[model samples]
Target: MSLRIEQVGPASSARLAAIHATGFDRPWPANEIASLLHMPASLALAAYDGDEMGGFVLVRSAVDEAEILTIAVHPDLRRSGAGRALLDAMADVLVRTGVTRVFLEVSTANTAARALYDRAGFRQIGQRHGYYADGTDALVLEKTLQGSGQDGA
Candidate 1:
């Protein structure tokens, strides 16, 4: 499939929310997504297959550090490289803005996501107990940027 990743704005909140809802059990509302997108520190990227949104990644950066707030891919489109592309696009944007590291939390039970992060060079740095709505532990992972030649970019 041909997937194009692009920086998105508040106007794309509904589409992001829709795609997010399809991937997660409890999705953020469009207004919440819009509000986050409107924040000065917030950045979002969306992956589109032509006119349809396939996935997205949202982040908040502060100084040289950034945290991935959320990442989601359409249920029917998982494992198709859209997630990796979104991450790569996000890293490209982050590097341009002087970000040196990116961090995110994934559920301990999500082996697929954990594997994806591992393959992307993220290392486990910590963990949070009962961090999810379902009382699952969250594994905190971090990836240190390596110049502008990294895979994600």
Candidate 2:
């Protein structure tokens, strides 16, 4: 069960979309993922198990702040450390890029995702009512980077 995390470029959009579709009820299309990856301020990290994509995390950075666009793990691979590896890779990139804070939104009903974010040091910062298609409120979580010393100026 060797897992490797890699920074994914636009060429890997289809693979990212496939894994995302398997993990979520609604997934972004490959073209959309490619467009996001083409953005200079955005990045995507993928966790691969041998030849298969296990999970991914997409992020957009602006100055010292960054937002997690989305994160997902293959349904069959959840709780197998893929999610955590993707997140750890994401944080490593953020720190290296001088991002000092990161934000994400999770459905209040998605206890698994909330637990993952909580374990990654993110705390509830705000909320949005009826933020999801199913009317589930979204909990906004934020984590501030510590000791990186990069101002992101």
Candidate 3:
């Protein structure tokens, strides 16, 4: 089945945490996700097939800007268009909410994610040294939304 994107709340925190644990060594706990979901600016979107989760993307907005807090696809679902779908879905939300610019940080070692963002029109503007616990640098990418995103899937 194809993945479907849906807005989620604090109730989905445990499930999100499970998926997050698969992607990150220092994954946020369920309580942390729950607390973020309770914030006024936070938005969470889950990609699911029927009731099974494929991935999730979480972001927070302030004024005309937004930042992607996290985005992950199940290991089994990688390269299945899940990440692009979530990104496109998020762009729609940000556009509707009048967000003009979106930003995200991805580890320089995460080539797949960097490629994805490149395809989506995010350009690297700077770098954060030793941003990850493993001493990996992070690429700070930003995309200026002009009514839509490039390669929105």
Local distance difference test values of all predictions, in order: 0.90, 0.87, 0.91
List residue ranges in candidate 2 displaced over 4 A: 148-153
lDDT of 3 by residue, 106-126 (tens): 999999999999987889999
Q: For model 3, state the Cα shift of residue 89 in Å.
A: 0.3
Model 2 TM: 0.93
What are the TM-scores, per candidate, against the unseen true structure? 0.95, 0.93, 0.95
Candidate 2 residue lDDT tens string, 33-90: 9999999999998888898888899999999999999998988789998898788778
For candidate 2, give the lDDT of residue 79.
Answer: 90
> For candidate 1, which ten residues in a row score worst on lDDT?
144-153
**Residue 51 in model 2: lDDT:** 85
lDDT of 2: 0.87
Off by over 4 Å in 1: 149-153
lDDT of 2 at 61: 97
lDDT of 1 by residue, 1-153 (tens): 899998999999998899988868799999999999999999999888888888999999999999999999998679999998888889888989999899999999989899988888889899999999999999999898867727442
Candidate 1 lDDT score at position 61: 99
Who wins the lDDT comparison?
Answer: 3
